[model samples]
Target chain A: MGSITLRAVSKTFGSTTVLRDINLVIQEGEFVVVVGPSGCGKSTLLRIVAGLERATSGHTLLDDRPIDNMPPYHRNIGMVFQNYALYPHMTVYDNLAFGMSAHKVPKKEIQTRIGQVAELLELQTLLRAKPSTLSGGQRQRVAVGRALVRQPHAFLMDEPLSNLDALLRERMRVELRRLHERLRIPTLYVTHDQTEAMTLADKLAVMRAGEVLQVGTPKTVYQQPATVFVAKFLGSPPMNLVRVESRTRGAMNPVGGAEEAVAMPAWIQEGWEDATDENGTIWCGFRPESVMKRRGPGGLEIPITVEAVETLGPRCHVHGSWGGQPITLTAEDGAMWTRGAVMRVAVPWDQVHWFHGRTERRIEPRPARLETLETGGAG
Target chain B: MSNRLSRLVPATAETPVRSAKPSHPEKHWRLPTDWREMLIGYGLILPSFWVFLVFYYGPAFFLFYIAFFHWNIFASQSQFVGLHNFAILFHQPVFWLSLFNTAYYVVLVVPVTTLLALALALLLRESAGLRGGGVTRALVFLPHVTPVVATSIIWVWIFNPNFGLANALLRVLHLPALNWLASTHWALPSVMIYTVWHSVGLYTVLFLAGLATIPRHVLEAAQMDGARGWLAFRRILWPLMGPITFFVVILVSINTMQTFSQIYTLTGGPHGGAGGPAFATTTDSLLIYQTAFLYLHFSLASAMSVVLFGLILALTLVQKLIADRFVFYR
Candidate 1:
């Protein structure tokens, strides 16, 4: 099985810990995206799984066998780096043939593998060209082909498309997804782009501060992030966090005490603890999309003064000040890429996420969401 | 406007009284022609030219001028013998032998030293980013900065007849210790060892700097594409370091051609022997000095100096022309 599992993995560089206690299980043929902001250890985690880095503690398992001490070559894992890492000295064919050659595959089999990979990546015509001569997209494809030629246990990509131009990155994302669909191989992809994490991942892990904050399907992580950090990290105009004290019957409750009754998230009703959280005091998070442009049932409409409008093609972003703080919400299917406009935005209460901000734990849930966080709060 | 100008300019009004400066183009800026700028330019250049005229061209041109006649450092009894001095110098077997020996010295030293230097440079350059690269680099470059005479003395000890460092090490290894400085068979090789040691440092530093110029991603990418140690080195590092290596080769070759301080200090004293035991260490410059200073064959030595200069020039130019085809710069 190509299923990969990381158990309590931690990595440190000198005194600074880069990744900490990462525990994850990727099922066979699962497509996973380890998404985080830059320097959040998403790439480091991917590198560790690829055996490019040695985990300082704990272990990684492929089919339940620990691989803490494995070298990259012995791990039978193919990695595509952000820069593509295509050998400038070698032709595309040679680049693709290299890994297989190192594995001591027969020359004929190597040729067959290269041919198949090239055909798959549509790089057959450029085999004789050196990496320096190829365009960015072509070079990236060759790098992928180099990995693909091995047909190893899994593929590890470290922000592999971040170097490409915007249009090309979008195009390659679809191509990569299509390839994954066809190959159906377990792949661990790292990217800081939430859009990429949402579009390409069969399962997504949102990481921050060298820790996995939440792991789930795209819909789950987007709607019900486990922590304030995840909530702030994963969205485009990231989820707005409003510090609201508990209120009972529209009156402020005693300081640091639970309110009698109020409309709250489903997970908050479950218990005092989940593995990631035991604290009762929580930070509420709601995405811009969840809080929509129109009024809907059980949705809270927050009043604000629009600061600016960012029109990104089919949709518009209404950035404004809510309760004397900046809050940006997506205007649903509106035509306003214009600047300086005011509007009231509504947040569907069922779609809001609540979490222990201190422990970075999911204390609230979204039962109405399409999917839920990895603890299986909702499906 | 007219009232104020009328009083002072009344005298000059007949000659068209305005500012007596030419002004035509609005777009043009004024260029400074002050003597200070000229003085500053002259000041900037004076030191180099002064040294060049006095030390470099002065000796080179004066050597030729003095070669036509004969001039001794101490004697007023100078004589002009036309080309007869060169004729005599050419006829003398010892002078010719010294020249031939010097040529042999260059032939033996240049290719061998260049290959060894380039090989060492490549190794040092490749491992420059690895652990202990700094220590290794410092050790390699130590000989270049150390005084040549000091190193020559150290090598002299190494090349001693029986109890020297080289023979002692050989004895420790249970290998036969051949007489180094004394044996005509080993004398040239002994000097070459010192020369290689002295020159490898400069080449290594040049190559390490050259290695820095090579983009690291290119090498890393090469590694990713499965180009391992040797292939990465031969194809990528070799091609990239060519210009620096060639420049160093030319420089070290010129330095080797005129290698004098060590030879003079180690082998040119009283009973210091003339170019080792049997003229094996008699390089071109040492031979030139023996003729000019010791024997006062100034004209002949000057002629020999011209030949050596020509040899150095020719070799350097040849290396440059050949290296041009292979040097990669980007």
Candidate 2:
């Protein structure tokens, strides 16, 4: 009953299309976080599901019933706004009770629900206090409490913790996850913060330019990004992407400038074993954490000149240029790497991601069986 | 003496002098550096204070002083009348009629103007995103900027009983035409209609400004809470608007109780000469003018002025008390 589905949804404001065709499904009791940069239509998509914005074309189904035509209140879904939007005139208890009272829930039931939500959110002592008198964290709790009191079929949060300080945002991120677990209500949360998207989502959706680029579990999306944009967006210090020309069966050269060839690891070579010709130019990507300083010949090695180093607690980021291309690699003991120093870094073939330069999409090798069938059909 | 001298003279780097004066255990007496700033602040306000003394407060005090005297401009000697003027005002039926008429006018105009202005402001706000909204707002506010007397004279024609626009509209609707402004029953009501029309625009503008200050998300949250339309207005908007609504009520009440020009100009001429049709439109302010200038009973007018001032002060204080208890400033 808690499942929500959006099918072929698109929205436009005047001449500008804010959201292209978007399809998503939130299974019952699942926590889905849509992550993207600003102006990416993530908030707009959440509003569409919350009934605050109407889709230009498509249907929104709740529990398999079309609910797009229903008003926000009739949909019985709770939404926490970015600003909290707590009534300044009302006390915390009254703010929590307002929605229930609007729905004409019995007075005793409203009281019971408010009591439970207050205890759950640790707002017992703050119920009679007005929102103006409460601190930001307290106000945030009251906002969540207000949404929680409805015992809603689903919850929608739009950057709820973006206003809080970093320390408090981290704590509230954990609290929000725990609250979702306890309530077990299907929730769709939207934020631009990568850490929140990575930690809080049962399923993550990465979006850009009015379209969802990829959706999967956090691990899968991080490990196997569907596009170059997804790969570049999800990780910190971001993934290093360099364009290269495949001139040999098991080696690649930096696209236009450097003449040095890089050896392809065994797994990639085995996947391309049946190919008659090398695929032209493609994008090679590897996470900063996957790059290791090496003096050996097993993996792809590129000589780089270090420009700067950033210390991040247990590790450091070495920013450098390899074959005229800027790259960053995470390393232990930042003291060992100095500015203007030249070093060799290597990445294993499995850790390397391949994307077509023209399409900017990941290039997965065709299975040998399928390759043979295509060859047979051509003959 | 040497310590005082050293304190007076500026010390250079080569002669950095330390005070040899013993520190007092008791309070020190010295002029503060900001004393000149305080003087300049007072000097800046002196002109405005002088103007208030000459125009507003001075006249009000003079009127209070004269309320106890039988003063005449031409007579060389004047006699102290004490409470006699007040006693005479109480016994006069015209004074009581004027008080009743003022009360009636206030009771009717204040609530009606406030409600109508709020409704119109809501409509304008809803239509603000649509085309021609700016023009419509200007049209609504245009009446407020036009001279009141000029508009009242024009309204005089609109409310004319015979061959007038008011009756013409009634006839077009197939409704029976009745004498307005000429009839005693309709004279006061006709003046009220004119007052509300002329002043509702200003209140509407104030309300529009108040509506603008409210955050849009609060209303959206209410909509999500199943409170729409009337329910939303009552529970969300009205309570949030407490401060502005209180201000509008007080302002409208004070203005309505003192209505004079529209009543004087609209109901003037052949039919009993303003506050006319057998004194149906004579409010307290109009009666005060008639008592002072027409009959040259300056003492009686002064006494009436004191009573009016007292009522306005008391009403404002009561509203302030209520506001402190109920109005939410933020």
**Backbone clashes under 3 angstroms, per model:** 1, 0
> On residues B141-182, what C-alpha lDDT tens digit does candidate 1 reach at each position?
888898988878788777776678899888889999888877
**True-vs-predicted CA distance for residue B200, candidate 1, Å:** 3.0
Residue-wise lDDT of candidate 2 within A1-379, one digit each (tens)? 3899989899999988989988899999999999999999999999999888999998899999999899987988888999999999999988999999999999999999999998899999999999999988898999888888898888899999998999999999999999888888999999999999999999999999899888899998998887889999999989999877656777877677464787876545565433222555668889999898875446678877899999989999999987778899999989988899888788876678877666676755456336646775210
- CAPRI band for model 2: medium
Give me the displacement of residue B61 in model 2, in angstroms: 3.1
CAPRI-style docking class of model 1 based on DockQ: incorrect
Pairs with backbone N, CA or C atoms under 3 Å apart (clashes), candidate 1: A291-A347
* Candidate 1 ranges beyond 4 A from true positions: A1-3, A25-28, A62-67, A74-76, A97-130, A150-152, A247-281, A311-313, A332-345, A365-379, B1-43, B61-137, B212-232, B235-244, B270-272
DockQ for all models = 0.21, 0.52
Least lDDT summed over 10 consecutive residues: which range in candidate 2 chain A?
Answer: A271-280
Candidate 1 C-alpha lDDT tens digits along A10-57: 999989999989988888989999998888988779878876578999
Against the true structure, candidate 2 has what lDDT? 0.86
